[model samples]
Target: MRWFGFGFNAFGQIYVHDKLIKGECSDAVKQVKVISPTELASHVDRSDCCLKTDGQIRASWSRRASLHLGGDSCVCLGGFGAVIASESCGISMKETPGCKDAFISELYLTLAFPDRIESWDLQKKEKTPSWSMEIKTESSGPPLNLPLVPGGYIATKPPFYRPLSPQLKAKSLALSAEHAILLSASGAVYTWGLGSHGQLGHGDLTSEEQPRAVEALWGMPMSCVATGGWHSVCISDGGDLYVWGWNESGQLGLPSRGLRKAPQQQSSQQAATGDLYTWGWGDYGQLGHQTLISSDEPQLVEFFREQQMRVVDVVCGAWNTFAAVVKEEVACS
Candidate 1:
């Protein structure tokens, strides 16, 4: 399997080894933006260490970290030539290999282990974790008490602790810098929080103080949902991908015009053709379109297709995107 990254490389967050700008000396080029999909090296500095395909890749505004697939260690790369490997810290990731099991913020890296949750303050540069807590688990089948994932329960940050309606059972949850999205067990999608850019998918740019159902997708049974800085996307059981919200960077995969307050028009919707696609926020080339031009509509990242590789999963950082792909096997007739 191979990993491809596109978007902001100002801090080397996307892992491109080539010079970002030509003619300008390497020392003179401060930031690099890849307008197209670029292959990423297994190691941040193009070192010999190999990264496993199943590892977790997490991105923040100016930093990127990847956890080894075995949950043994993680490598972090940051702006200004900052490279840190957590292997020496002796922090065990044995039970936190899942991508969702770890989270990275502007100043903190939190890992959800089977027995506890540990948080490290990146800015502090402390060898010991700033704080940690043991998780209580019931002895039995399926590990009764697992780390908090997007599900029936809701976890809030700071002053925003809105609860879901009593009757609504959430199957998954996604949160952005301003809004939140919930996928109910029944396949109904609900949203709340900041909606200035219409990330809530309520057909209006009104911030919802409480969780509200997205009437536009009322009868559509969605299987998965995701939210970006100021945009939202969901996948239908039938394999259709719907997108909405801020189009300034063409993250919605539509013709870039301006701010959009609703879901894309029918033609703008993308069908899940088993190919990796991206749009919007390409100022940093996070959309993987190969050109600095931000796409207002979903565009197939042809790099993978050209290489006969099938993308298995994708993760978005505040300013970058990483896709895990494997070689497609051709059946001989």
Candidate 2:
């Protein structure tokens, strides 16, 4: 699991095995090992549930497991509890890392969580598992089958690992469709459902089915947070980047691309001005600001700040947005 890379690959996405043509910039950090041949690999333990979380999934290796199991099991499924994603196929969940186990999914009708959670699955495996029901868990785990299509989502995703809590430590989470944006451990940034489209930033649009607390990002500590179906993002460990909701299409690379019902616009997360920041929706630009327009607030994406580069990371797709920049011109002689 030691893979390093460098940038621009005219369609290889940045692949340079023997270097037949990786296209651009292998200027350094090159070491991409590959062995290939995985059997049923598909596990997501809260790598933001597979789209937006911490990390962990370096080399799952388990056509049927034998020598690549990072025990302590595996936690961090959806965040704040309860998860079972699997749109169709690609499943691999079984890591009860911390405790409070019991997930049971397949046809729905078995979801009971009082606390102590952690789960996975999202896509592939829907033969006839119908009959939906949420809120049932007392201690169950044998009657399973739902691995990717119950509320887990998967158009394409891979990478997860989050759930270590030294003391309420969550860090980030952002599910969006109805609403969700949690960030624990001390950065504070919770939210609930159906905020009409303000995306629960709390400026308005109303609707707090639970979760609460986004009181203007309260105390500003946020390490990272993302959600874009309406809008809501966070990144203030000094990196700044605090967006709001629904921009129509500019996706929050704001300057105002319409859809401003007047409410969520508080700004001032403070410090470190530019690294990455997008908005609600950007027709196709996905808020990268190439065009397509659709913004609400938080905007700043100068193609990685015109090349000085620093964007540590950021991912959002309900419309498209992904960043991971690095080169601040790193030299050395």
Please name the candidate that would achieve the greatest TM-score relative to the true structure.
1
TM-scores across all candidates?
A: 0.76, 0.24
- Each model's lDDT comes to 0.64, 0.43
For model 1, the superposed segments whose C-alpha errors exceed 4 Å read: 16-31, 42-49, 71-100, 137-167, 258-273
Cα error, residue 236 of model 2, in Å, equals 12
Residues 1-333 of candidate 1: C-alpha lDDT, one tens digit per residue: 677777777756665344521333366344467666666674355342245666657667766666664545444444323433333233333323442355666666666565665666656645666666655554632332111332233232322223456577666778776677888779999888899998888888899978899999999999988888898999999999988888777777776657354556444445445588676666666777666655566667777777788888788888778888888887999
Q: Which residue ranges in model 2 land beyond 4 Å of their true spot?
A: 1-123, 126-161, 175-182, 185-225, 228-241, 244-250, 256-317, 320-333
The window of 10 residues in a row where model 1 has the poorest summed lDDT is 143-152
